[model samples]
Target: MHPLAKYAIGFVVLCFLLFLLAPFAIVPSGMRGVVTTFGKVDPVPLGEGIHLIMPLANRVVRIDVRVQKAETEGDAASRDLQQVVTKIALNYHLDPAHVSTVYQRIGEDVENRLIDPAVSEVFKSVTARYTAEELITKREEVREQISRALVARLTPYGILVDQFSITNFRFSAAFNQAIEAKVTAEQNKLKAERDLQRIQVEAEQKIASAKAEAESLRLQKQEVTAELLKLRAVENQRLAIEKWDGRLPTVSGGATPLISINPQQ
Candidate 1:
């Protein structure tokens, strides 16, 4: 064997060794790596970026820490025993600080095994407390109840909840039709009340007008006394005298004309 050939073989062996054992692991952005040794998860979680690890003994499982959406639907009975179908959307992410703990207990499929069941359980529990009528009328309250319940349930498992929303609530067709018909009937009743009030106001105005006219006639009648009648007759005679020319007419007595005239003096 030559000395150069021995050096070449040593270099190839070193390269092969390096290839077989990864010197370091890369944790990408928005993810945390849970370190495990011989299938046992380490207590401490790995933050994003490169981290030193044992070549053949350590493994890194990258779990996403970014916010994610999980939408699910289920049917539950209301307090009134009405069947209600609810669709809910949950926004959550694994706690970056507890990635190792989460991985150890629940593994990678947290959304399905943990978050989904949590949502369904909390929703059904909260929904059962509200009657079907109250569910529709107090929707926000029901949603709040469900969200708070989920937060409490998942927190211990190192799942941080971002937001929860109830996307849809469906009721039976008969119940929906009943609600619509009730609303229409209430509207008709309100219209009738307003119309009756308007008619009453118009009647009051007409009665007031008639009373005012009658009062005016009574005042005119009260002023017509005997003195007023005499005064009217005297006024008419004075008007007639003002219009007459001063003259005397001859009168016939026993078929003879009697004329009386005075000479101008």
Candidate 2:
């Protein structure tokens, strides 16, 4: 063989050797790698960065240990046997130190297999302890209960529950209508009470006005003298004479007819 051909073959061998020795695996940030040799899984997980392992015998499976969010919807029965549909948002993360164990036991699909079911179960358990009305009105308390229960249940499984929120709660149509009707009735009752108060205030004002008028009349009567009374009687007689028709007076008794004179004269 020629000298150049030999050099080309040597270069090809060097390249093949380099390719075979490339066993470095890079575990990205926020993730851990589970190293398995043949069929046996390593107890210690590889942290983020480049790691060297047996090229052909060892396989690295990366599992994300960062916080993740999931939204789930389900229905549960309340304490009063009312059906309630709930939507929840959950924030959780896998334990970084137990990535290998989690992979071996729970697999990478933890959200679907473990967390989602846990959420449903916790929701059902907590919801059953309260009535539907209480669930709707006391939503914060219900969410806290569910969160505590989920944390207690999932913590041992190498999963951490960071937060939980009840996004929506839906009830049956009949119940919603009843709630609306109840609200309307309460508003009407308040309006009726205000109207009654207004009427009572008006009635009180009228009574006060009548009492004031009676007092004014009594004061004027107290200010009257006998001479003033006589003057008022003369004025009344003058007004009656002016309004009388031209007719002779008819007397059936032996009573004397007296004439009145003006006090100004």
Candidate 3:
């Protein structure tokens, strides 16, 4: 054979082998590839790494199996008919074992078709069961109800719910104003009660002080008898004599001295 012909034949064989062994899909970590043959999906899924298949007849679509987030806000009415705007966040992913089923039905746009609608439906249903005030006070209960409902609704479709959260709840301005006024009124009422108690305590203290003073005066009055007065006068006279100097007082304007003294014996 000619050298050129030999080289051409070797090249053809190499090309054929390369095409035969070409990997059609490279499923990455945290992903699963769903295989489709001639537009029909196969229930079995392809795992991570390279996969070989018939060229041009088979295709692979990768579905993420990692935890993903979805957030949406919507308006709903509570049991009391008050309008409530709710924002929620959901964490979920395709069941790794059932990625093929999920892709076949829901496709890659899980957030739009599955998550958002499910959240809206469950949120509205749960919100309808509680009043606007309950929705605020029982937020954790509402969250759990939504989360459980989501899991029940989605698990059958091969979607898994990891976590759920209610981000915000907005009410009408009038309702907000009402709530604020109510809180202020309660605070004012408490302050008024405290002031009343303090006033009562102060009045009680004044009454007790008056009673004590009256009791002391009555005791003093009872102790001061006529005999006691006479004894006190005599005691005062004796004390004055002991304190007197060894001299008699002179008359003032020919009047008698205030303390009469015949002589200091």
| Cα distance off (Å), candidate 1, residue 52 | 1.2
Give the Cα lDDT of each candidate: 0.91, 0.91, 0.91
Root-mean-square deviation (CA) per prediction? 4.6, 6.3, 3.2
How displaced is residue 64 in candidate 3, in Å?
A: 0.5
TM-score of 2: 0.79
In candidate 1, clashing pairs total: 0
lDDT of 3 by residue, 229-251 (tens): 99999999999999999677886
Cα error, candidate 2, residue 79 (Å): 0.6
Which model scores highest in TM-score? Answer: 3
| TM-scores for every candidate against the unseen true structure | 0.85, 0.79, 0.86
Name the runs in model 3 displaced over 4 angstroms. 1-9, 16-23, 225-231, 251-265
Per-residue lDDT of 1-265 in model 2, one digit per residue for the tens?
A: 9999999999999889868776779999999999999968898999989999888888999999999998889789999988999889999999999988888998889989898899899999999999988998898899889989999999989999888888799999998998899999999999999999999999999999999999999999998999999999999999999998956578888675766768998
Give candidate 3's error at residue 57 in angstroms: 2.8
Clash pairs for candidate 2: none
